[model samples]
Target: MDKNHPKSISLTLAFSLTALIFYLPANFFPFMSIELYGNRNTSTIWGGIVVLVESGSWPIALIVFLASIVIPFFKLAILFYLALTATNGKHLQLKLKLYNITEAIGRWSMLDIFLLAVLVAILKLGPWTTVEPQMGSLLFALVVIFTMVASASFDPNLLKENPNGKVS
Candidate 1:
């Protein structure tokens, strides 16, 4: 890897770490709030999944859980790992494969965001009902964006570099 490659790797790791930082609040804080006839219902990502399971929508819940929670976390972890090990001169093929897979699956992480948008759009009623995204949605979106950027920023070539800064 060249000198600039190290900077690129560091940038990727930084973004991955930033996404991880955002991921916590994104899962715990309220993602959306619905107010109907003066009654308010607020839900975080996990809370929404539980509601879905309670309502016998386990499949949809699983989809949401995977897209929102599992996939994003996986992408971040993979990207962070790749960035950290880029110059270690080991597992080059495996690191490249992981990076490619992470990039390929990155779009699926936005599934939750699109679903929330559709829900908010479909459930918007007149004065009696309102659906608004909460802080968690914004934070979650950031996590997705940062992870995607981090994945994209990763240079597979780094995996070919030796620890002494020589390309294999």
Candidate 2:
């Protein structure tokens, strides 16, 4: 199928755009804020990782850092590259495999969101230590969801090029 196919191209473009837009704020904003003992503390996803590492939970910290920070950004970059190359009729077998892997990992990128949600739910101590959702969480969620949709919507056939170096 050609890249111009409405459903395939449009959905891929939409998801890629959304992922690009949301990724910025997701990394910049605080993911969670905690108010305890008349003091407020904030943590971005990375900040949480630092705290975890400092507290000697290195494994959990690394997992969260990689899954939440590294994976999402990597997935977005891969998706954008795939979409651009596909639209330009470039073909690469490895690109297709990378795209599929990105799609598979996209869902796991939501682990940070799930962790935040759980923290907020379980740590609501009514003025002791309250975890509030922050803008970063929202943006992060958007990034993950959009990437997932983009992967699903992308036309895998676009990766195949004709003899003339144009999409068939």
Candidate 3:
């Protein structure tokens, strides 16, 4: 019964919860604001997806929806589940697979941030047009970061431990 194992589980849960808490505002608030010819447009995660869909970029919209919204949330849930069941001996294989998936999808959570950065860099037309990241962008980045740390802090080997904390 190594103490670090439980500590790792606690850390994972803490980070995952924190990420979940931040996720709401990230999607609801405006992440990007664009001023074009004195007309302003502010877009949240859902708003961006809707705009993409309306612009006939269904594939890109789907990818953004999944990468920015779905994947981070899914990864957080998987990490939370893994932490909760780390000491249970049952379903070790399933837990391991889920943990691996969480780790794999962790990088994708930053897709929104990357896209926002590129947009800001590209759309800096002085006095006519500009793209700026808003508070939601910062919150979204935090959610992604916290979830990544949560996934990384999770000890997959704990799935092999029995209820007594001994490997079975």
Candidate 4:
């Protein structure tokens, strides 16, 4: 991998772009739908957070917002910065640390999906409340996966290499 660090960066950029592309619909489109007492409620990721905030669960709302919305965008921005700085010969260590952070916190971004899955499984109470995942949830999962792959494929050492991002 060291011998081909530049190539890894290229692949990382590709995956990061793909993840960013998936991010839009994941936030705006309906993530899940719940049916209860013959009423249906559809919610996107941000809508869930808004509902939580409105319902007085401020802490949970903040957590979901941070994990789902803030962190993904942070990771994407950091990845973009890392890729740019790697070739521009600037902020090598800071960007490397940021890269480590993005890699470490990557999985936690899927918390919303995990919670929804658990709710769907346990809420099978005969027309009381049934939760079903929608297309946006799948896209969000893909975004997480793609970003994780991008982070791992990124060679932080390349940031300190030549201005062209070629390995020594």
Candidate 5:
């Protein structure tokens, strides 16, 4: 198969754009709702991080910020850049390195999802303490999965560079 095929590049771009569409709602809306003794509270991913920081759980806050926010946004930006440059035949080595970085850090971006799953499963104190995922969790998972697909569809071999760093 031709790794430099235009179809593959366009498909990667499409997925990356779709991922970005999902990202806004995912990060801004409530990810989970906690019910305790007839009281309920909803928190978005950012809100959770803020709560963690406010409560002095600096380590967890940092982890969430890096894993959920920084990594995913960086990946999306890199994916868009890669898609644009895939057919340009320039910066081959640099693009390859960026792709490798994206793949390496992809799994880490799912940390928030794992944490939510654990919380929903473990925080089951009947109706007194129930944790449940909301629309934002679904959107967030979709964003992560779509970004993964976008990265996987991209072919690093397509990046070609002349000695002058121009598409040849």
Candidate 6:
């Protein structure tokens, strides 16, 4: 669908901007709150991951950290780079690869959201060990969804070199 088209640039920018906006609150707010034995505590995404690591669940901790923090930031960076190059009509050889990777891994970012949802649903201990969704979880979920849409909407053809040795 005219991969190198201007529409692709617009889509990428829109996605990246939305993600960037959400990222701030996602990091600052708590992702989940737990109440146990009359004591209540809230955990941010990093805090949750730290708990997992401290409890000896390294794999899960790593996965959550990557999906929630690393991947989203990487995706945003890639999209911004792509958008910049696209606007200048500078054909980049790795455009296709970058776009594919962005789209492919976008859904993986949702892993954090899914985990939060599951925890909220399944971990209901009637005020003993309840898991409630936090503001950051909602923002993070929106970032993932918007980024996925943006990546999918981008056109790969924009990365192709023009006949005059120029981009697009």
Task: Give me the candidate number with maximum lDDT.
Answer: 1
lDDT for 148 in candidate 6 is 81
Candidate whose TM-score is highest: 3
lDDT of 6 by residue, 100-126 (tens): 888789657779877877776766746
Preferred candidate (lDDT higher): 4 or 6 = 4
Q: In candidate 6, which residue pairs clash?
A: 3-155, 3-157, 3-158, 4-157, 4-158, 89-167, 91-167
> What is residue 43's positional error in candidate 6, in angstroms?
0.5
Clash count list over all predictions = 0, 0, 0, 0, 1, 7
lDDT (tens digit, per residue) of candidate 1 on 1-168: 467675788889899999999999999999999998999999999999999999999999999998988888888888888887777777778988898899789768788889989988888846688999999999999999998888878877777755765654
Q: Deviation in angstroms for 53 in model 4?
A: 0.8
Q: Lowest summed lDDT over 10 consecutive residues: which window, candidate 2?
A: 1-10
Measured against the true structure, the TM-scores of the candidates, in listed sequence, are 0.91, 0.84, 0.92, 0.89, 0.89, 0.86
Candidate 5 vs 6: which has more TM-score: 5
Misplaced by over 4 Å in model 1 are 125-127, 161-168
List model 5 lDDT by residue over 29-98, tens digit each: 8999999888899999889999999999989999998888888999999999988877666667888899
Error of 1 at 92 (Å): 1.3
lDDT of each: 0.87, 0.81, 0.86, 0.84, 0.86, 0.80
Q: What lDDT tens digits, residue by residue, belong to model 2 across residues 1-168?
A: 453665786678788898889988888899889987779999888888899999999999999989887887788788778777675654577787887798678668778888888888877846588778899988888888888888889877777776887765
Model 6 misses residue 71 by how many Å?
Answer: 0.5
Model 3 has how many clashing residue pairs? 0
Give the TM-score ranking, best first: 3, 1, 5, 4, 6, 2
Q: How close is candidate 6 to the true structure, as a TM-score?
A: 0.86
